[model samples]
Target: MFEFCADPSTLETGPWFACYLTNGVHLLFYQSFLTVLLLLAITAPVALAFGFAGAAASRSHIAPLRWFGQVYTSMVRGVPDIVFFLFFVIALDQALEWINHQIRCPDWDEPIRQGANFTVCQAAKIPLSSSPQWVHEVYNFGVAVFTFAIVFGAFAANVLFGAMRAVPRAQLETAEAYGMTRRQSFWRVLVPQMWIYALPGLSNLWMILIKATPLLFLLGVEDIVYWARELGGSRTSQFAYPHPDWRLWYFLFLLVFYLAFTRVSEIVLARINTRLSRGQATMAGEAQRRAGA
Candidate 1:
């Protein structure tokens, strides 16, 4: 990044460190932090949508829908996250390729599953063999997003479902007495009030999701954890910039980053909870009313 970076070996302490930090590899490391943030940004809302759908499905009048939602939440909650992460990505990828193979390779007679290997025709390959590196990375990141969403969505669904049920029965009855349809009562009366109840659970889930970003390494997204380990390992003098094993420092930075992130999240969530609590019959609202009076 600097002209003095031409010979890193010739540089003094300050310049050496500066140039080392600004190198191409270090730039990637910096970018990995953004990758983690982007994952959280994209995953949170998508997972919330999934959770809402699942929660609504569980509460549906249709027996099949309710059963499916109940089963989804129960099954996912019971399974270990690592197991689901490993299994789901492969399964979802293969399922997509398999469907694509059927559509794009109907003329081929070769079996997709021979012994243990699952193979699809070149045309049906995800991103195709000729695609750019960025396309492959994007596809992998997308798979990671969906996997995170599905797993976290189940937990969110349980939280939301409980929140929905926590809304007072009297309120719903009153809405019905006023001639509001079930759907109208739910959307207009119940949903708005449920956030105060759901906020605590969702806040904790957000923290967990933040902690789980390291799992992106397993999904091939080259996340912060991956870069930390890569850059922190000792490099010999033959490399452009030699360094001793610094993984301890690297991980310490991660620890600090997460702690700060979660601390800020707590403050933000508290404010949101306070906002949602306003004018409601909940204890927080009642306390606010007393304080104001």
Candidate 2:
């Protein structure tokens, strides 16, 4: 900002605009875009992994495992997403603090719940009461990531559960005839084949997940949405950088960001769908064969 405009007060028009846009706070605002992307990148695969485990557990011969998977997958279906977001973050925070209290302050005899306050020993507070600002930010980011995984993982499990069942029963029978144990055939055969059937539903899920990234604000993570509203709100002339209510423009930028992201994703997913279709008996495979001939 200094290189662009030595004194923002002295500058006008072009130089002033340049310096204002490149201000330190604006830079942090730009970096929040990366924060959103990183959360998506980290959360998507973890959610998928959890979903896979849930789907497999649902199919397990063990009764307790099957019940757990069913309950987990069903848990999110009837709840409003916004309500769940608010409820889970608070619930998870308290749950962690309680566990920490149990471990860190075992000798303390006071009940944690006293009237409206849920207090733990100072040592048991997440990030501790004395930890630095960055520690708090990191902890909040972690909770946001985990919250996203749990909710989306349940939806992914349902999609995968259906996809796994869609695989031809004859395929599994053929694997068993070759003396493959249920677990062996499951890993080598069913898992490989399930994706072809699952891709459509999973692709929709990926898009939904992309749209859902903005919910990080509700979880108290300083995400892109948070910064956008902060930076674009009305700024008084008393401030170094004064501006009107420019929130409309800020939101327009986010709109374009998400649009470009989804556009690229659709292209990539289409390519992957084509690749996965090879040698399968789906209509796409038939079309590919006809095209080659």
TM-score of each: 0.99, 0.97
Per-residue lDDT of model 1, residues 179-232, tens digit only: 999999999999999999999899999999999999998888999899999999
lDDT of 2 by residue, 38-104 (tens): 9989999999998999999999899999999999999875677779889999999999999999999
Give the Cα error of residue 265 in candidate 2, in Å.
0.5
For TM-score, the strongest prediction is 1
Residue runs of model 1 more than 4 Å from their true location after superposition: none
lDDT of each: 0.94, 0.91
lDDT of candidate 1 vs native? Answer: 0.94
Candidate 2 clash pair list? none
- Point out the worst 10-residue segment of candidate 1 by lDDT: 217-226
